[model samples]
Target: MAVSNQEQTPVEAEERGARARTARLMLDTAVQLMQGGIVPSVSDVAEAAGVSRATAYRYFPSQAALVQAVVDEALGPILDWKSASVEATERVGDLLSSSLPRIDAFEATFRAALKLSLDQWAQRQAGTQGSEPQFTRGHRIDLLRDAVAPLRGRIPEAGLDRLGKALSLLFGIEALIVIKDIWGGSAEEAREVVLWAANALMAAAEAEADKS
Candidate 1:
């Protein structure tokens, strides 16, 4: 019997969906092992993901490759910030503040990314840069400025500088360690710190503007 075009499309779509699910499951297992300090092996991950060693190996050829892909997928939300235009710089802070909730939501993923980045850096023979994408810090700063731009008159130079520093430091490795590893705060707490800091800066900016 000949398959109709309509039936073929659904079959193709199902295949795509199944592949996506399998890929995601593999990624999730890798992340879980990473989080647990297990240094996930292919066999371990395969078992966790409920797939055969052959299937797991087919999907991820090596530990580094699997780690790279999982970390990339995990950081997708933050790295893909939608910058409408260069004019976005003016309101970077606001846009960044809006992402505070999202930041909290993905704290585990973020924590795992920090570890992966460090591992990559260590492999660079101690002086070279890490394997992680460079956009993390730069993008965060860019978005911060964009969110704060509309309140420029309200935000003093010192205040803006402080805000930038906070975003770079608190929102990066430092905060990842402090909140996730040391303090053991939930994702919500991590995000709240960022949001509160941003809002405080905005409030201070507003106060300064009022004095003018």
Candidate 2:
């Protein structure tokens, strides 16, 4: 029996909704485990969430995949960040201010993701990471590029790219780990350092642009 498109549309939507709900459940479970200082595998999360292993595996095939999903969820707000300001410096400042607090709050989760990525790197170096999906991290690139869009023509193309890359260092978990953990700075101190570095980078870029 052939189903009309209209008849199948609602069914497909419902199925998608169900899948999304299940995936969210697993992610939430994973985050909880991560917060408790446990790096959970997909099977661990599935068992905790009361979901079937096969269905959970369909959503996150490995520990790396599961942790990556949790990290992405933690960073969902930053990924959707938008600024209406046309001033590149203001736009970048706003993004850093808005995102730094979120990163501080999820410090543990982000550090865990970093640890997993480093573990993968080490395993690959030892030729032990056979066919496992790698969890790559790059959200800061697009966000920084968008923040500096107003400076696109003002700065040389290579300069714009360099600015974005430099700003990326100040935007994410790495900054928190450095300023807060390694340097023993408070959250407020970390934010100040990041803002200072970001502004300095912009000023240097602007100065170079003036010379050129």
Candidate 3:
């Protein structure tokens, strides 16, 4: 019998649903393990998810692939975040106020991703990293640009770029770790620190634009 090309048979539909469930299980397991602050291999996630190595490997081809899925999970709402306020400073503040908490909540997972990226960097430097997919970072750049987007006409392009760079240092897990672990501040304090600095940078950029 010639099967319809567009429609899945009952068996095919069941297999697709089963595959999706298995992928979700492995990804959930990966996120749970990453919460403890270490990036787990595909095999590790498979074991923890009660899945066999072959099945896990079939779902996720490598450690990088697993981490990528978990990173997307960790990023979730933060990636789609946008500010309703029209004010540049207010937008920046809104972005920080909303995102910092999420970053802190997923601090362990972000740190794990950072560590893996650093490892890949070191391996590449030593000419030892072979055939491994590099873990990607730098979501902050676009987010910052979007946050300060209201200043495009008011500030020079370079000033806006500089502001984004300065803000990046005070954002994300790096900033959270500094404010929480090093400065020993509370989450509220971390938010305060980022807001103050972000506001100050916004002011400085506008001030520079005035001079321009």
The numbered model that scores best in TM-score is 3
Candidate 1 lDDT tens digits, 12-99? 8899899889988998888777656555666889999999999898888766667666556655676666555433233454455555
lDDT (CA) per prediction: 0.63, 0.88, 0.87
lDDT of 3 by residue, 46-96 (tens): 889999999999988988888988988988888898888788888888888
Q: How do these models rank on lDDT, best leading?
A: 2, 3, 1
Candidate 2 regions exceeding 4 Å error are 6-18
Question: Per-residue alpha-carbon lDDT of model 2 for 20-63, expressed as tens digits?
Answer: 89988888999998876677888899899999999999999888
Residue 67, model 1: lDDT of 63
TM-scores of all predicted structures: 0.53, 0.90, 0.91
- Which scores higher on lDDT, 2 or 3? 2
Clash-forming residue pairs, model 2:
none
For each of the candidates, the C-alpha root-mean-square deviation to the true structure, in angstroms, is 6.5, 2.1, 1.9
- Enumerate clash totals for all models, in the order shown: 14, 0, 0
lDDT of 3 at 27: 89
User: Can you tell me which runs of candidate 1 are displaced by over 4 Å?
Assistant: 1-17, 34-43, 72-80, 83-90, 126-166, 179-212
CA shift of 183, model 2, Å: 1.5
